[model samples]
Target chain A: GAGVSQSPSNKVTEKGKDVELRCDPISGHTALYWYRQSLGQGLEFLIYFQGNSAPDKSGLPSDRFSAERTGGSVSTLTIQRTQQEDSAVYLCASSPGINYGYTFGSGTRLTVV
Target chain B: SQELEQSPQSLIVQEGKNLTINCTSSKTLYGLYWYKQKYGEGLIFLMMLQKGGEEKSHEKITAKLDEKKQQSSLHITASQPSHAGIYLCGAVGSNYKLTFGKGTLLTVNP
Candidate 1:
């Protein structure tokens, strides 16, 4: 893809339901990141994937949040038993390498009611 | 935990005016990146600064990293309506993760 692509630009789900957000990073980008932005808040790091290495999950807010990158190209972020607090913009970014500026996708606005 | 603090939570300026936004970090930054985001849109990468005391400019936007590497500023000269958006500063930490400030919302009135 020419740039990072995210699916389901907007999602509204009932609380307790699970949701999956997808990200297709730029071709050959070795680094991928997931971030969540609540209303009027900063971008909060959720997870990071570098090549085939184990993902850095230190930023995940809780065990209910999990992500996986398949074949080092596409990634999926799944939020289990979503809560109202999970309503926010979920952003995905990719870079060629560490310390490089990232290209971010438009993001998925999740609303858990 | 690393934290980035941005000042002037929001600003409204008339077109042709100049404005500056600041971002301070609790810890030394290895990399600082500037991005612009419209409401409900993705972030647009503006610039990246790595070295202490380094400055970079693109068009009317200039970003500077202090020698201490703990703070950065983004200045927009002759602001235009197109510049209205949320300006964010992100810093890369030792863990290779990026942490961002809450952002400064700039409103350039034409």
Candidate 2:
């Protein structure tokens, strides 16, 4: 079985630019999540989508961060006007639902200079 | 404020030794998940605990959830060099999001 997949394994961009990271969740997985892992830091929750609904968007760091899941399959996390602080590994994960284990993608490492 | 706190920040052990890592939460946890990540890679789910006093084991790894509902521990028996990586504990609340600990960097020496 194919696991979750993310695009552009690594991205380097200048400050003030925008980057879009894409995630393709496993088939039939209705719950998708995006998280950021800073160097030597924990995984920070960004946004989550469950069947076209995001009940919790509170974890998004700021207005510059936004994510959308289309057709309950693919998800895109966009970071607007990127800063050095946003230079981290962006991770995507999908689960069957509550109590199910989540399968994560290899992640897109974003380096802002 | 961080909802979950993992201790020891790091650990180093010889191959075939035993090691334990702990995760404590400021709030009650509805579910606890353990994951391992190799350098420059995504996390791989190890185990999940949903109820207090729950215990689950996978191969050489075992996990226990306290009845108090705020703590969990992951124990590795007969550690191998392949276990060298970052161990993270994630706690889920009523919300859908998962709050992760800072992770324990484990270095298993062969």
The best candidate by TM-score is 1
Clash pairs for candidate 1: none
Q: Model 2 Cα RMSD, Å?
A: 1.4
Interface RMSD of 2: 0.8
lDDT of 2 by residue, A28-98 (tens): 99889899999978898888899777888988999999888889899999999999999999999999987
Candidate 2 lDDT over residue span B1-110, tens digit each: 43889988999999999999999999888899999999999999999999999999999999999998899999999999999999999977787677799999999989
TM-score of 2: 0.95
Q: Write the per-residue lDDT of candidate 1 for residues B22-53, one digit (tens) a residue.
A: 99999999999999999999999999999999
**Candidate 2 DockQ, CA atoms:** 0.85
DockQ of each: 0.89, 0.85
Q: Give the winner by DockQ.
A: 1
- Which residue pairs in candidate 2 collide? none
TM-score of each: 0.96, 0.95
Which window of ten consecutive residues has the lowest lDDT sum in model 2 chain B?
Answer: B90-99
* Candidate 1 structure quality by residue, lDDT tens digits, A1-113: 89999999999999999999999999999999999999977898889999756458888999999999989899999999999999999999999976689999999999999
